[model samples]
Target: MPTITTTDGTEIFYKDWGTGQPVVFSHGWPLNGDAWDNQLKLVADNGLRGIAHDRRGHGRSTQTYVGNHMDTYADDLAALIEKLDLRDIILVGHSTGGGEVARYLGRHGSERVAKAVLLGAVPPIMLQSDTNPEGTPLEAFDGIRNGVLADRSQFYKDLSVAFYGANREGSNISDGTREAFWLWSMQVGVAAAYDCVKQFSESDFHDDLAKIDVPVLVVHGDDDQIVPIAAAALKTAEIVKDATLKVYEGAPHGIVGSSYEQRFNADLLAFAKS
Candidate 1:
């Protein structure tokens, strides 16, 4: 279990495998770097170095009662990258992890980072406000917060369906998939999970997005119900000057794990290479 202690003393467990150019993956809320398992295997076999880390309080990382915000997440990642002295890194972040990626690049990135990818990312602010009129409502995030505070287990279980778009018509509700998602969610602390709701839902990333000057790939599913493609990915492409958008029709939020795994992997590799 390889780990790097952040400035805040949190030990972030990470996996650095393979060789050649490194592709670092940051996972979504509540889940660990294991969420990028599909990506790691594919990238590693294709002659690229693949790395993924368990965010503090998620997976193998130490669970702390404090410091579970986007800035902290970015800072911790920056520390890891600096400690390892990684270069030509391709930063890939999904869901809340995308916020961390944007903030990391905004605050610390330079010529070292080759490019970035935001897949079903939570960014440019998720909660609706006067300025972010197209974002999700604060009440919606509050509902999630209340549910997690009430019963984290059940809340995560139910959210699994929404996150994978299992509720849609003709959607095959896989018990195994749902169970895996629930287990992943349960791996994190209730407090960390709850705090991350605000980290992903309320924290603004518009300024961070504007600061990126590298080629960015935005991969999103049109049928994604957890984080709508319109409000999240599409808006992100609009904000990032050098971003390219790839919209998958009828695909859910977990595009990499869902039925579109082959297509997703191929497209992602293509984007990374190009």
Candidate 2:
């Protein structure tokens, strides 16, 4: 249970394992660093340092009622890397964590980052507005907020379907996967999760996206029901100078845990090696 104290004194929980070039993983919203357990084992076996950290208000980290925004998320990650003096790092971020990675690079990047990967990430912008009219609508996120605020348990249960595309025809739904989703959601602070809906949904990462200079690999599912591949992956590829985009057919938002998990991990490792 190793931890790093952020600039604001928040104790952020992190897992640093194995020995080699480091690959720091930042997980999606409502899920902890444990989401990268599979990736950790695979990367470690391949002689790479697999590091994953739980953001504040998620998992073992402090459940403060504030500082759940993108700025704090990026700052916390920067502090962790600085404290560790990690360089030539490979940063892999999923969902909202992608925004965190982009912001961190924009704020604290110093030639330390070698490569980056964004998997079904939230970036450029998630919400549709004047500047980002092609993004998801605010009403959609509001519905998510309403559902979570009203009945968190059932809300997470229903979200599982879209998260893994379990609702689709021929999709298999397992009790273990459903339970894991619930457990991960429950580990997140209710207040922080509620407030973070704005951070992930409305926050714009256009500047951050434009700032990334390292080689970037964008992996997205074509059937992602949560964050559309077009608005996220395609848009991100256009902004990042040196970026490669890969799309999985019929894969859900949780492509990393779906049948394509191994493929996703393989691509990540290949990218790290190249």
Candidate 3:
């Protein structure tokens, strides 16, 4: 098992494949690096190296009693990149991982990065605030927290329906699909899983987005129920200086391994090479 030890001694498990310009990936909350398997396979087959790390306290990483927030998350990413001496990198992030990418660039600088992609990402902030009144209500996030504390197993299983739009009309999502989501989510440590709800919901990324110097590809499903396009992808595209936004009509938050898989993979490959 490949891993990188953070400054604080967290052993972050990672998958590294292929050999070319590197594309480092970050996964969403409550999921390990394995959530990006499809993307990893696609990228590696196309001659680009794909690297994804399980965040601390999630999956094979250390389950620590401290640092379960964005700052530490970004710093851990930086430590990984530095320790591995990776450069001219393309960073891809999904959901909370998008915030991690933004925070990583803002906090540590993107001197090593070449380009970036944010897919179904949460950014600019998810919780409603005075400045961002269009954001999701605090009650919704509170409900997420309640669900995590009340019944995490059931919560992830239930969340899979909306996450993949399985409940949508004419949807063909399978039972195995939902079960895969549950399995990925269950790998997270309870403390990290619980604390990440707040991290993903409330971490403001306006300044961080503004700080991004590399070209970005922002992809989102128009019907994304978890991280709504109106609040996340659209706003992130607007904030990032050079971003090309792609909206998949009628698509759900989880696009990889779905009908949108080929389209997304092509776009990602094109972006990485561009």
Candidate 4:
């Protein structure tokens, strides 16, 4: 149980494996560092260091009653990186983690980061605004918050189906994978998970995306239902200069550790080596 104590006294559990050029992974909402297991192993096998932390209030991390927003999330990551004295890092984030990485570079700058990758990420903003009319509606997130408050366990179990595209036609997600997602979601604190619904859906990343100067790879599943490509990855790639876009045909949102793990890992390793 390796961990780091944040400035606010929250203990963040993390996994660090192998050694070489470093790759730091930030996972999606309601998931712990375990979500990056496949990616971490792949990078480690390729002679690169892979590190991932359970965000505060999730998994083995402290279940604090406050400070669950994006800013605090980024700060906590910064503390982890600084405490470990890591350099020349490639920051890879998935779903909500993508927003965390964007906000991290926006606030902390890219001095230590060499590259960034966002997979099925929520960025540039996920909520509909005057300028961004194609974004997901607030009602959707509100429904999620309500679902968590009403029956968190059942809510997560149900979400796992869509998260891994288990319900999609031609989908072949294993029962074990779906169960793993549910178990991970259930590990998160209800309060933190509820607050994060707003954090990921409402928090605007326009400025954050603009601040990213390093090489960025934005990967999204064209069939993603959680964060639609029109509002998320598509818009994100446009906002981040020199960002490369990779659209996974027929892939679902949970691509990294699920059925697309091999392809995802290969792409990630190639990017890390480039």
Candidate 5:
């Protein structure tokens, strides 16, 4: 596996393909860089460099006992960009990965970033509170923590139903897709998976969204059961100065699935070229 050693000595595995302007992908929780395979291949074939990394404690990356928070997640992203000398980059993140992109711009600035794309991302906060009525209930995340700590294998398998809207009536999500989600999730370190539950749910990204100076494309499914469109993508687009919000009607959180792959890839290529 091609890897880069962070300052903390964690080995970050990455897949780099094609040439031309760089497009860096940050995948969702539990799943690693492999989650972005569909998008990566599309970008690479369209004359752009596609790079996705297995975040520490996930996939091929070393399992970490410390630094499982969002700050460290964003910092690791910065380290990758710096090490590769990638410039004018387009940052694409999905689910928890979206939070990473927002935090990265806020903490590290967008000196090398040309644009960003957030797909079914968690941002502008996911915790329900007095101020944010549309946010997810605290109990929901508690259930996730309990699931991971108790029985992640079965929990991940069950969670894929909502992750890709497989439970929806007239849905076309294949068993392979759901199975792949479980397989990818099982590769994650148990402790790291537990820590990430809080990272994705509690971390506020308002300041991060406000600081993004590059063009941002925010995509979310109106029917997303994981990260509600109203709380995540809608709120994020409203906060970012140059955000373009795109809501996929009747779509689920995992828009990168086979059902949505073609359309998602097309939209991504258009945005990257724009």
Candidate 6:
């Protein structure tokens, strides 16, 4: 029910709970602050203020027709932090949210931030090029765009399976988890979701990663199907000076709130306390 109006007048919905040093969360693409519910409750229960905001055009935030790129996403986050006058905050981001954190620190600086965490995040770069040939192909992103344009609901449902590793063999993912992912995905505006596909896939965070000077915890699932660990956390950890890398052997992309939630919560709490 709480909201912050960005400079552009976009109403960004947020959830702030408990009291202590703040641990701010940024959700992934096509998802909202609710995606961090488990982590937020965990941090709040442990005597920390947990805050998460729905990016513009996602969830309860104003579904604007423009400003769906990473710069705007990062600016929106900065606006939230400044409006709340939050300091000594630990910023944590997952999937696309990770990119947001990186850009925020890069564009806005780390004057008020204490630490940062990136879980199954897309950063450094995710698209293949002459210099970064291991990145995902542009055509793959095109396929996602086409799918969303065709039947957004079905596309989200199908993506949820892979997003949480439900489609993988021997995966113990539950039906509810997949259902939640689909519901969150559907809450995103059609145009915003489509534009984010390009933003997350094409945006390069090389400079952003380099700009981060605070302690960073880079956690990734080796078996991640959505944003492959090789192109994301691995490179990210290497780029950020003195970053701690924690790899979950068989965990999938949605490790933040799925079966791996316990492990993530523990790591996040430990880092926030450290």
What are the TM-scores, per candidate, against the unseen true structure?
0.96, 0.97, 0.98, 0.98, 0.98, 0.98
lDDT of 4: 0.91
Give the per-residue lDDT of model 3 (tens digit) for 1-274: 9888888888999999999999999999888898889899999999999999999989989987689999999999999999889999999999999999999999988899999999999998998878887789999999988998889999999999999898899888889988988998888888888899899999999999999999999999999999998889989999999999999988888864456778898899999988
- Model 6, range 1-274, lDDT digits (tens) per residue? 7899988899999999999999999999889999998888999999999999999999999998999999999999999999999999999999999999999999999999999999999999999888888789999999999999999889989988888888778878778888888989888998999999999999999999999999999999988999999888889999999699999988988864445788888888898888
Q: Across residues 1-274, which tens digit of lDDT does each residue of candidate 5 receive?
A: 7999999999999999999999999999989999888778888899999999998899999899898999999999999999999999999999999999999999999999999999999999999999999999999999999999888999999999999898889898889889999999999999899999999999999999999999999998888999999899988988999999888888898855554767788889999998
Sorting all predicted structures by lDDT, with the top scorer first, yields 5, 6, 4, 3, 2, 1
lDDT of 4 by residue, 179-249 (tens): 88889999999989988998999899999999899999999988888988999999998999879999988
User: Which residues of candidate 1, in runs, are more than 4 Å off?
Assistant: 256-259
Residue 163 deviation, candidate 6, in Å? 0.7
Which scores greater on TM-score, model 4 or model 5? Answer: 5
Reference-based lDDT, each prediction: 0.87, 0.89, 0.91, 0.91, 0.92, 0.92
Instruction: State the lDDT at 158 in candidate 4.
Output: 91
Q: TM-score for model 4?
A: 0.98
The clash number for model 6 is 0
Off by over 4 Å in 4: 256-259
Predicted model with the maximum lDDT: 5
Q: Give the residue spans of candidate 5 off by over 4 A.
A: 257-259
User: How far out, in Å, is residue 118 in model 6?
Assistant: 0.5
lDDT of 2 by residue, 1-274 (tens): 7999876778999998898999999999889999999998888989999999999999999887889888999999988898888989999999998989999999887478999999999998889877777789989999989988899989998898899888889888687887898899988889888988999888888898888889999999999999998788999999999999999888998844455897898898899899
Q: List the residue pairs that clash in candidate 3.
A: none
